[model samples]
Target chain A: MEPLINVAPYTGWVYPNETIFEWSVLIAVYPYLTGLVAGAFTVSSLYQVFGFERLKPVAHLALLTSLCFMFFVPLPLLLHLGHPERAFNATITPHWSSAMAMFGYFASFYVALLLLETWFAYRPFIVEKAQQRKDLLGTFYRILTLGSYDVSDKALRYDQKWILWLAIAGIPGAHGLHGYVGFVFGSIKAREWWSSDLMPVIFLFSAIISGVSLLAVIFVVSSKLRKIPIDLACLKGLAYTIWGFIMVALVLEGLEFANIVYKGREGVEMIMEYVTGPLLVPYFILQFAIGAILPFLWLSYMIWRGTTGRALIAGVTTCACLVLFSVFMMRWNVVIGGQEISKTGKGLLSYQMTLFGKEGALMAAALIIAPFLVLVVLTRLFPPWEDHAKSSSSLRSHA
Target chain B: MKKVSNPSLAARRSFLSKLARAAACTGALAGAGALGVGVAKGASAKTEAKPAAEGGSFPTKDYDWTKHQWAFGVDATKCIGCLRCVEACKVENDVPRNAHQFRTWVERYVYLEGEDRARIDSQQDPVNIAASGSEKEYRFANRYKDQKVDKAFFVPKLCNQCTHPACVQVCPVGATYKTEDGVVLIDHDYCIGCRYCVQACPYGARYFNEEHGVSDKCTWCYHRITKGMQPACVEACPVGARIFGDIKDKQSPVSLFIRNNRVQVLRPETGNAPNVFYVGIDKEVN
Candidate 1:
């Protein structure tokens, strides 16, 4: 039988209780999911509110992806709780001072906004299907229509207005949720790695890149699966989005690291040792070198050469995958990495990640994959395809 | 155009408006209900009477927490690295019988002949645990006996019970809280076990109690302290190294410890303003 707790081994003089790691791999997965939700919503809002016409092919798909990922955002957190049954206690009787107490309210509001926006965007499609088919699936669509089958030109215009405003409100609703996740870590004065004024902005930029990269990968994969011709312009638009945001993310991250090293506060020696020692591979090599810089340079080259067709598809998809991995590494470094350097300025504790437990790596992987699985089912049910978006021609016309 | 002039269309419009109004009314009622529940919970939590200290009650009889401002002090110069206080604390508090989880422990800082940094090792260090021969026992090893030590001293560490506790500030459900008489306590039943408080504590005093699924820390033995008795560690100290008393009395041990000596608290830079004072500890203690 396994022990109830996994005690981390330490080198120097860590506090005795610090041996047991509190936050696990599941905690890292939480922010990663929230970032993807915020990023995908950016793509949807770009088309609906900002009129980024070239991104039209993935606009509806983006909305659907955001909603699907948003659905599973709370699972990793809920699973990590010691008492999952009492999770509502934070929502019902919140402690106003805590940074974490506001999470319940922010997440609930964002989920509602995503639902409403997705409904308005799909109202035309739902009404059309409800009228054409009398099968069981049609019954599902008819109920989903909420009895407002008025698809007249005027009604369509009303729906368009609602969609535009909802997408606009969702801009802050999504990014605020992700930015707040950053504040939760940044505000803690305990860990030098997490405490910085630049933390929230860094998290925000990284979240944007991660979300956009996710949409790029999903758009290309789904297009290939459906045997549809990949839209070169839309793909280029995503590549450019990643290219722009990745630079900000990189700079913010670099500044955060530099501030830590330059400040050279009480625990700088231990941190320097940990980074150059145990953190060499995970932090420098995997996160910055391969995951971030390699993709960034590849995309820059592609853009410079005016790459198109199969070459663009291959280039952008690979870069998106790299960005996704890099962002996950960033979260891991911030969450687990902070804990690995003990609060006692004199020691280091290496987190022993397990394979099969509740807070294990396997569970973290499942939580990450669960969103895409839901997206597949949701796409099939709602048919957020570009060809089916004929009813809302205003959206396409803007494009 | 025909649909625009249809009379039934006007009727359908009225029905949809009614539907919208009805939905809005339900939403408003639900929101009010939620607020009502939240207010009620807050009120009950506030008004619940403290457990009286009567006849073997959990809190000692006639002990008023509001009237007493408790404080702790450590005189490291007097400590002998005996490990009795650590044993007494584990038994009294029922802390897990292991080398890792400690409510209070002793650190032996040794500076050998030519070292710039103090070689610090607590009783939880592996060699000491090996000397004790079991996780259930406590002892310090004699490994440093052969070394040419320039200086050495023992520092007993416990929760400082800061005036502005980072742990209490980060508890999402307000489960862990500061008491009126300067102590932090946890409501085990209410804690969601998110461990945010654990992460927020700079001193690393808080630890998750796996058995109870709640964060745990030294309360200065709140049950014993409220009963007008010393904390277990102070009572078990053989060298008069640990001191506990209410600063409300000017002549109390803790008050004199503060008034008579050049006392200091650990990590004053944290702005936590720790209630536990220390004397005879070096600059490298933190």
Candidate 2:
């Protein structure tokens, strides 16, 4: 068996127990998954709530993506927990003062909201599948329908209304959930790196960009898989969404960094040492320059040139992939970076991630991949595609 | 007014009765709270029934927690880096027998003749662990023995058990909480082992007990302190460097230590309002 604790190597003077990092890479994955949930929900809401017609093509995919990722959000946390069996203890007797105590409530409520909205958004598709087939797949759709088989114009209108309200409510539900994840770090007064009022806002904006970028990639990739011509208008809408949110994310992150430096709190010296030394590549080079700036500039160039057709699709897809990487790096920089700077105000510790263990790098990779695998199954069952959805709605109209 | 003989005796009796009544009320409340926590844990019913929840007024049946507000004091100037307190704490608390996990530990600070900063290392340091030659035992290595030492002192560190404890505040399940008498503790059975409290603590006093899958830290030896004895560390110290007492008694050793000297708590800016007081520690001791 592997050693239960992985002690980090350090420099300068850290507390004896500081050698063992409490939070690990799994903790970083928690916020990364939540940000994607919030971001994808944002895309669905753009069409459902604000009437972004150009975003209609990927809106159903957005809701499905959000739900799939939301289901897996708690897996990393459960795996990281020492007593996975007693995980519900937090919910049973939550300490009201703790920022973390609210996680169970927030996550549950958001999951319910996502499920309700996903059901309402796909109800038409489910009704059609339930009536059209008589196989095992048909039984699955029948169960998903929850016995509600109304396909009339009035019923469809009511469903649309419910979807709209759910999307409106989810705007705050999803974003608030992700922002609270930020509060979990920001409220920690011990670490100078995380104790900033701007942390939640920074996390909120980054969540928006990551979620939107995820939708852009999923939208482009699924279109190719179906051999369907990509919708330029919908892709542009996602690009614009990513472009808008990424700017805010970059600015908020910059200001958060500036606050840390300008305050020059007791631990700032070590933080400075960390950023210049071990943190230079992850924080600056990847999260900022290559991950963020390069994509931002690329999207801007494409938009300026009145880019269209295959060039636009390739450009946006590449940019979306970069933004996704950037957001993961952001979570890494926040969660792991906070731990790297010791609370001693005089030392730094480098976290050594192992290859195989309960909280190892391999498990982290598996978690990231698990959601996509679930999405593949979910998409097959629900078929959250634009042309299929349009035909189903039209079929309902003729009924 | 009615004529009364020996008025002072009557006044003293009245004061004693009020104190006793207050103590009884506080004890009742603490007992009820603990029972509530036990019932909550028992609701799950999967784990085999253990003894009455260890956290609530069960140990030392006659001990009254409400009457004592426990406090500790460290005279850093007097420490010899003997590592006795660290070993005693481990043996007494059954803390993990390893260099990385410590319930209580000591730090050695050395300021060379020309250096402005104090160099710091603890028994958990690889060099010192090597000197001890076993993970089960601990001792500070004499690494600085050959160098010309200018100024040096050993500062013994443990859980501060703060008045406004960050650890207790961040515990999601309230499995770890501040007792009425002032020591912060964890209910191993109830903790989800999320380790959030371990991160919130500024002093790095807390560690995850991997064996038990729960967060553990220096309780100031809650079991011993409640039984009217010195903590294991205090008893093990050869010199009078470690002090533990109830500050409620104005004449207790810890109370005197605070009154007779200028004292400081670690990381005062974190506003944890730590209960552990220190004397003869320099500015460099976070």
Q: For each model, chain A TM-score? A: 0.97, 0.97
Give fnat, all candidates: 0.66, 0.72
Q: Candidates' TM-scores?
A: 0.93, 0.91
Model 1 Cα lDDT, one tens digit per residue, A44-112: 888888888889888888898999988988999999888988786676556667999888889988988
RMSD of 2: 9.2
Give the best candidate by DockQ: 2
Query: Compared with the true structure, what per-residue lDDT tens digits does model 1 show for residues B121-190?
Result: 9888889999999887888899889989999999999999999998888888777777668888777767
Tens digits of per-residue lDDT, candidate 2, B1-286, equal 0111111222222443454465653423433433344454344232313222222325655665567888999999899999999999988888878888888999999998789999999999889889999988888888988788899999999999999999889988777766667888787766788999999999999998887788889988877776688899999999999998999999999999999999999988899999999998998999
TM-score, B chain, candidate 2? Answer: 0.80
Model 1 ranges with Cα > 4 A deviation = A393-399, B1-61
TM-scores of chain B, in order: 0.83, 0.80
Error of 1 at A323 (Å): 0.4
Whole-structure CA lDDT of model 2: 0.84
Question: Which ten contiguous residues of candidate 1 chain A have the minimum total lDDT?
Answer: A390-399
